[model samples]
Target chain A: MDTFLQVLIAGVTMGCIYAFVALGFTLTIAAAGVVNFSYSEWVTYGGFFGVTLYSIVGLPLWAALIGTVILCVIMGYVFQWVVFRPLEGRHFLTIVTATIGISVSMGALATLVWGPYPLTLPTFFGNGTVEFGGISFFPHNVLIIVLAIALISVLQFCLTKTDIGLRLQATAQDPDAARLMGIPVRRMRTFAYCLSAGLAGLSGFLVAPLFVVTTTMGFGLMLKGLAATIVGGWGSLKGAVFGGLIIGIVEALGAAYISSEYKDVIAFLIIIVVLLFRPRGLFPERIAEKL
Target chain B: MRILSKSVIAAALAMSFAQVAFADDIKLGMVIGTTGPFAGGEAPLVNGTKMAVEDINAKGGIKGNKIQLIIEDTGSEQTGAINAYNRILDQEPSAIMNTTVSGFVLSQMGTIGDEGIPTLTGAASAQLALDKKGVEPLFRVRTSDLYVAKAAARFAIDNLGGKKIAVLRANSEFGNSWLNQIQSVLTDKSVKPVAVESFEVADRDFTPQILRIKDAGADVVIVSGDPPHFVVAVQQLKQLGLTSKVIFSNAGVLPTTIKLYQGDSANGIYGTVDSVPAIDPARADWAKRYREKFNIDSDYSAAEYYDGVMMVAAAIAKVGTDHEALVKEMRTIKDYAGIGNTYSYADKGDGGRSVAIVQIGDGKLTLAATIK
Candidate 1:
């Protein structure tokens, strides 16, 4: 039972990180007809940003997070204007290739800027632990779970309750129609990129305490998020979030019970099994992109 | 008859010219990691080897002849390592150095012996590397993984006063070696393992393994794997409030490991290391010069690989262009002082296996003591 609880906590924390990255995937797909493969870079941005502020410059923990998120949002706009905007009416392959190019460039940029060393962030919740009913929990783990849930709620509200939300829905549904109705589809796409990157930045910030901030850190997380998106039902926010949790839990259970050596492999194996059985995904596939 | 003889002489001269064009240079094949999950483990060696080459050449090189190291990335995987070794063998380097994979070293040894190339690398952890007749053509530069485990066990028993211990290992050469070495030592000391948990290297979640360890009422957790496994285990340990001390092998206690745990949780951790980070007053000048050149602190991985390359240079210089002679002399280098360490390569068939222990205190990686 204690072992079960331990795996459960690890799964939830890891799943939360995946969910945060997945949230970025869902938002970008919803707002733009193209999935931004470069969303993973935002997580790296968040981590490096936090490391600079908190470890090097010695900012308060919360301030570093906020600053990193803001920088990530701006960086998303830079990508949109510099790379995504130019390919507005190009072939899907062109757009995809361009995003891949962006990813490669960002990866190199990360390597050049940070060197190839791993970095750790200061623990925000202190080095304390809480034990309840024979199960113990790290303070950071609890804090991150709370933060992920809160961000989900906040993002959901912004998507449903704001004027921008209506414009975003109209753009995603039919960019031509949205434009005819004065929705400014291009601006909406840029806005989505900003929102997506903000979430990734947040994910990076929270997970920095757990994993060192390395150039390769975000790529793995991004791939995991992509897997989550596919398993939860392609392009569905609900599905992506759900899929992230599933991947995280499967990894924990596999590491705990099956084999620790294949913990990472287990996450992908579960995704494969889900995909083999449900071609459309565990949930209804949402139309995140349109021709 | 005179006209035919003159034509034959001209043909012979042309044939000799063609032979010179296609002659093979003395290529030193190397399996240095350029990318992948384990890239950090071996990148320093490549850079430091280059520095060693320059330093040697600064003194007019090996017998006034320039040495070349033909390096290829091992990709930090088994298949990648195999492919790299096969390609490097095609070039037929006079000597080779394989990076940090025990399996790769053993696998490539047969080919190395067949090809008649002497390989010096710190990556292989097997004792069999020293067993020449049936060994790989490669020699290990660092302590054998067997020695590392013994050092870990010694540190646990002698310093940490650990009697009952828990073992957490990844299912790799590193982990397997650690488990075998420590298990034997623990048995000799009559300390039964409280619990044993194994995980895959790729597995990020360690909750199940940690929980099993906690349930077994262990006093210390000995880990043998890459930094990620160690980080995940340490983070999960803190999360579960399981304060059983973590005892990691040398590779387990890399600088990257402390960075993974945010330096705070790294406190109170004990592990074996290859070399001290040259911070002592005795080695401060060396550290300062290395940092000034590379913008990074000097580590044992670099120091030892640098020594290996220099040792190769010493042999090559003595033999005066005889590759076979260099290999023979590499085994008999007597009492040569290097970087404050003695090097006399004993063909007892493996290079010496030695270790040091380090303690993480106040978020800094500090040298504790030398563990034999």
Candidate 2:
């Protein structure tokens, strides 16, 4: 029972990270109407930015995280204008290819700036293990699990029960109609981009303590998050969350129970099985009826 | 027409003079991992190479002809390693200083042999030194994994008095070879490992593996992984409260890795090293110089590279610029005291003959024993 609990916690913690990254993917697909493949690079940028502010610049941890999120927001805004907007009227594949190129360029730029050494940020709770109700946990792991849940819940509330979110959704559903109805479609899309970028930054910050900060860190997260997004439902926010958790939990449980060497294979096998059966994922996106 | 002929003749004469000067300088080529997962280890290796080049030139270079050092970055990938090798070869160097990655070296063995360049490497895999295809010109400048693995297994059993060992290794050629070597040593002693597992190089979490090791009730766990992977494993092992005496391979015992690791997690951990210049009084001068120069503590990889370059310089000095002659002279190197270890070039391409076992106390390494 203790072993199961330990594995569960590990899985859930990892799941939160993947879910956070997957949310960015789902948001971009919904609002921007195009997948930003560069979310992977944005996650890496978040880590390097955290390292720069907290480790090199000596900012307090909370201040550094906020600064990182803001930087990512600005990065998204600039990218939308510089890269996305210029390529918006072209084919969808063009935008995706450009985003992929941007990911590569960002990775190279990071290597040039940070000099390729894997760095670590100091954890909030230090190295002390926390014991609660007869179970031991790394305090950072607990922090990741709790903070991810709280932030995700707040984001869900803002999206589902707020005026700006309705406007954003209107823009996503039909930008031409939304523009005719006095909604600033361009600004709405920009906001979605910023929000998603901020989420990616937060995920990267959360993962930095658990993993070393490296230029290559985001690629793995990107793969897992993309898998999660697909498995949950294409563009459904709730699906992204559940999908990430499933992948993380399954990966951890498989590693613990079956062969550790084939852990990734097992998690990916879940994807194959899910796709074969459900096709559109566990929770398919709902399309509103046309008049 | 007369003026044009004069200018052409002058240009041709100057070009020939330039070529003569270039030929007078001995070009030594190097390929080291400058990016990706191997970057931390690359730091010391690069610094050591730089220092060696400087020292050799300052003492009046090989045969009074200054050594020209040309380096290429491997990007820590197989393709990158091969590309770096080709780029270095384009310079038409006298000899090539090899990459520290065993897999990288193995991939390029045929090319290196075909080129017939005297190549020296710090790669610890015993396979590199074997009498195999296209490895005749390769020389290992560090202690091979066979000796390091033996020392680690022996230390775990004899020094730590650990029984019921568990092995967690990276799923790579280097990791598997080290596992085999260590297991062979254990089996020779009539001891068998309780459990064994493997993980990819990029894996960050080791909770599953640690829990399994705990479940197996292992008294000792031998980990074969690079710095980044090993650092995570150590932290997770501590987080899960594993009481096993953990032993790590050499790459994870470097100063850069020690600095990245949380201090408490590293305490009581034992690791094998090619050298511990920090604790070895004989290497105090070199270590001090390295720290002052690079503003970083030198690890064995750096020292090995330094020794490799110096060995090449020595070979060039003894046998001039002839590659075959240089290879013969390199093999004759006996009791050549380097900053890392005293090297004697064996017939199997081995140079360095010793390994050290160290224990981490409060994140700092203390030399436990040196095995030769």
Candidate 3:
């Protein structure tokens, strides 16, 4: 049915966004051994940065996106050096708490600078709907899905086939062993943080036109990303993507068939069911023992 | 006889001191949500309240006593509102202006009634507020959601000829109230909505909901929600290729929301508003001044709050800050025209029944018809 296809496409589009943010969560957790709770705020900052560049400064979409990435990367490094670095050798709980503090502070800062009203970004792709096989889809939605898939594939290739990727893997596996192999483990961790932040920023930039840009926007995405990571598998990139897609499709279907009020509840129920049946998630991280 | 006279004199002196303390300056307490979900409209409400106080004082103050406004921020939660109400009560203000959220107002109704402080709310329009017994001291400056919903339903069915309607609303007090009223009015007209969906205030994706509405083949979609969410819903509805007519509740009349979707996506979306200053030259001048002063577009909240503050000032001036007298005076106010709308309280303290249907036109709200 066209309605079913439309819902499917919509779910996939949302799932892709969840996957991007989940990728950030998995990247930070894998590389740093501490979950960056503030990862979603990076996405929010990225959107605000895009608003400044595109809406206020009148930059082209691509140029504004590039500016957003640069700013987010710098912010990632600044947060790492300023907040996470000093607590590097401290207890894991300390780092997590610090990340929470960072998240709150970043949200408050965004609100202070931009106020609470949501800002609009110019649509990059044309706003027209394209009909394909009797189902209508927005060009922007298609672009988002394609871009998310491309980004994920590129990240996958880099993680599997590059020297820096190997270094990152080594650092995440065992910092002491990685350092012994002359892998500059700390620098690799910083690099992972930057990449994760950049991904979050990119997701924000891409989704801003679809949704309104607000400081609280990242919080919802962060929760969804966390849910995806939990449902897929901790510290598994592929699992995060799969988890995000699963959440998106399940939520859409649940809302359509059941009640819209329970859509979020359905997502949480899936997380619980996954945790109960397989604590390691739907796709358990298998490389730990191998590494 | 001498000892008893001395005690009476001391008691009289204490009572006189208390009266002097109360009369030093007329204090009005304001509870506004400056953070959390409601912060989007906080700036204008606070600015309007402040401007009203300034306007009053500049005119030689109420009977030469300067009106003082003590503001408290309800962090957009019931507990926060209750706490702020308690703090405001500690100041012993002559009257209180509560927050915009109906849930917060409902939670504090018993307390407001027990304290017998004449309270005015600019935005909370839940019918439950009026349905409750013992809410005598509570007054609403804005029209109730029930009234606004009736107007919206009439416009959609009567004017737009939307036979098959779909209702989409946020799951909040505001949304729920509007839903009930719209359903009641539509049922009375023997037209039932094809589909009804509710989303959370923070929800960004309405694709699933829109798809369902599209499938139902509704001729028009009636929406009731806060800003940005409404804006996103409209955009999504357009994107989903559902060319159904869209009608919005009073909450959707915001200029900022219209500007967010100013293109073809925003055209022909109808909404009801308490007032459109462009219709009245005097109101237009006030709106212009308010925009210049606050650097934000003037919405119903700003205008209603300004009028609310002035109403409190007027009551204080007429009754000299007597709590019971002030409550009586507020109820007795009849057709007191403010910048936004006229205030005339019914026996139960509900005011402002005038509304206008406005359609989005070229990034602005153009008045279509006035309903009383």
**Winner by DockQ:** 2
> How well is each residue in B1-372 modelled by candidate 1, as lDDT tens digits?
999999999999999986763343446668866665566677677767877777876777665556677888776667788789888878767677777666766666667677767777776455455553334345557666677778888777788787679989888777787888888998889988887788765456667787778777887788877776677766677777777777777665655456456547678787777666555577677667777887766777777777788788777766744557777788786555554244555646456545788887765667777875
Candidate 3 local lDDT, A1-291, one digit each (tens):
877888888889899999999999899777767688998789988899999999888999999999999999998898788987888878777888888988877876887898877787877665667789877777888888999899899988988899888788778878888899999888998898899889888988988877778777788888889889888888888889999999999888888878787888887898898899988888877442322
Q: Could you tell me the lDDT of residue B207 within candidate 3?
A: 80
User: Which residue runs does candidate 2 get wrong by more than 4 Å?
Assistant: A286-291, B1-19
Superposed on all Cα atoms, the candidates' RMSDs to the truth, in angstroms, are 4.9, 3.5, 3.6
Per-residue CA lDDT of model 2 for A148-263, tens digit only, reads 78877887788789988888777777888899999998899889999988988888887887777888888888888899988998877888899999999998899899988899
TM-score of chain B of 3: 0.91
What DockQ does each listed candidate score?
Answer: 0.34, 0.59, 0.50
How far residue B172's Cα lies from its native spot in candidate 1, in Å, is: 3.7
Task: Report lDDT per candidate.
Answer: 0.74, 0.84, 0.82
The CAPRI-style docking tier of model 3 reads medium
Worst 10 residues of 3 chain B by lDDT: B125-134
Off by over 4 Å in 3: A286-291, B1-25, B90-92
Question: In model 1, what lDDT does residue B248 have?
Answer: 76
Best by TM-score: 2
Ten consecutive residues with minimal summed lDDT in candidate 2 chain B?
A: B128-137
Per-candidate total of colliding backbone pairs: 12, 0, 0
Q: What would the DockQ be for model 3? A: 0.50
* Model 3: lDDT to the true structure: 0.82
lDDT of 2 by residue, B1-372 (tens): 999999999999999997886468899998987766576667677788889999988988876788889989887889899999999989988888878888888899878888888888888887876564336678888888879988899988888898898999998888898899989989999999998888877677888888998999999999998777877887788778888888999867787778778867788888999889876788899889998998778888788889888888878877877788887788787878888877877555467877899888876899988876
